[model samples]
Target: MPVDRKSLFKRVPSGIPGFDDLIEGGFPENTTVLVAGGTGTGKTTFAAQFIYRGAELYDDPGVFVTLEERAKDIRREVKSFGWDFKKYEDEGKIVIIDGVSSSVGLPSEEKFALEDKFNVDNFLRYVYRVVKSINAKRLVIDSIPSLAFRLAEERQIREVLLKLNTILLEMGVTTVLTTEAPAPQEGRISRYGIEEYIARGVVLLDLQERNIELKRYLLIRKMRETKHSMRKYPFEITSDGIVVYPSGEIY
Candidate 1:
């Protein structure tokens, strides 16, 4: 008898509307995915939605490690989308890990705060401890470029992320690691140009001049182990959150 490899993995439903169908119902379990985009491309919203929807709808706990914005600011920002991150955090369904306060030498009001932002090992251990505490099933590390600021060399950055990937896999969680991508480039996908290779999947969100307007689009540049859409699909940021039109195409 032949073996079905994909059947060995379970799908981790992405919370974004119309998004999961494109990726075969969701991201693969126990894999780290990279969400890369330029400014105003809704990278944060997509990643946040993954954490928020996982906790609220699926009964899956999540950990959102904000690297760019403070935890309170993120909570407040996502409130407009009707996704109450703080509410879930309060209920122990999710954790908003404050990576910002430690970077700027400030005290975070959030329950979880990284004590040392400069040491990659310390940051990874802190995340490990918090994720285990909640038994979280989904994880998001917003904007890896901010994390790059903590390290002095690209080698160290890659090594740290590889370690982080291993940590996420060991915990059996589907993770979304966000990073900033430069504007409409030919080949450059991420700010540091090294993040795409570190994760098992890479999703790109971009804005393009289409149909006489600047339309937002999303593409799965690469997703290892599972068949996924290769076309640039249209998406929007609504009051509810991001919604991907899997059937719609751009260009």
Candidate 2:
């Protein structure tokens, strides 16, 4: 039987300024996407904008699982863009899970001591409960690396991610997961590179020096079951949100 590929997937518009055009309307519905970039590359901002726009423009409820920053802090940061996350919370349009607060008092280093305790299963369950409670159509796990850092073993990290992917897919909710990339000089997509393997799509944000100025560029490196633009597009972070200039030059 010939497969009706179009019927298999739906597009979920990110609603970020000038971003959806690159991916042919939006991300694939109910698929996990990795938004990988280095420090100061606006990964959180991009994810937040996607969630905010989903609720504001598309009428889709979203859940933000913050692994690093506080939920209140995220709300404060996005206030400049005129997105009152708190108000959305009050109306049940959005929910922010404080992954950081829950994991507080843990060591900040990459290695965990033998006495330290971290439960990936419990965290996943908590997130699952929240998602179900809100009936969220979209979700954002801000920085998978931060959550993985709490675990000591590489196998544990991979296992948690695999389980998370399965859980999100089963829920039929589109997800955007952020991960820290290697240094710009290394030209790597992510710090561990495992996220790209498990995700259905990968969007890379990078900052480069062009004409003695720092410029941001966005690229859809890989998106399963869809053909996306391969060319690098210049973008900027404004008071409104992240804006990509498809026809603009980086230099």
Evaluated at residue 196, the lDDT of candidate 1 is 83
lDDT string for model 2 (93-158, tens) is 898876665467644332111222567777777778778888999999988888877787755778
Error of 1 at 232 (Å): 0.6
lDDT of 1 by residue, 1-251 (tens): 88765576788889888988887778888888999988889999999999989988899999999989999899999999998777887899999888888788887776788875468888888889889999999999987888888787756777777788778889888889999888654678887677887788999998988768999999999988788868899999999999988887565
Which runs of model 1 end up more than 4 angstroms from their true locations? Answer: 1-7, 183-186, 249-251
- lDDT for each of the candidates? 0.86, 0.83
Q: Which candidate is the best by lDDT?
A: 1
**CA deviation > 4 Å runs, candidate 2:** 1-8, 106-117, 184-188
How many pairs of residues collide in each model? 0, 0
Q: Which candidate is the best by TM-score?
A: 1
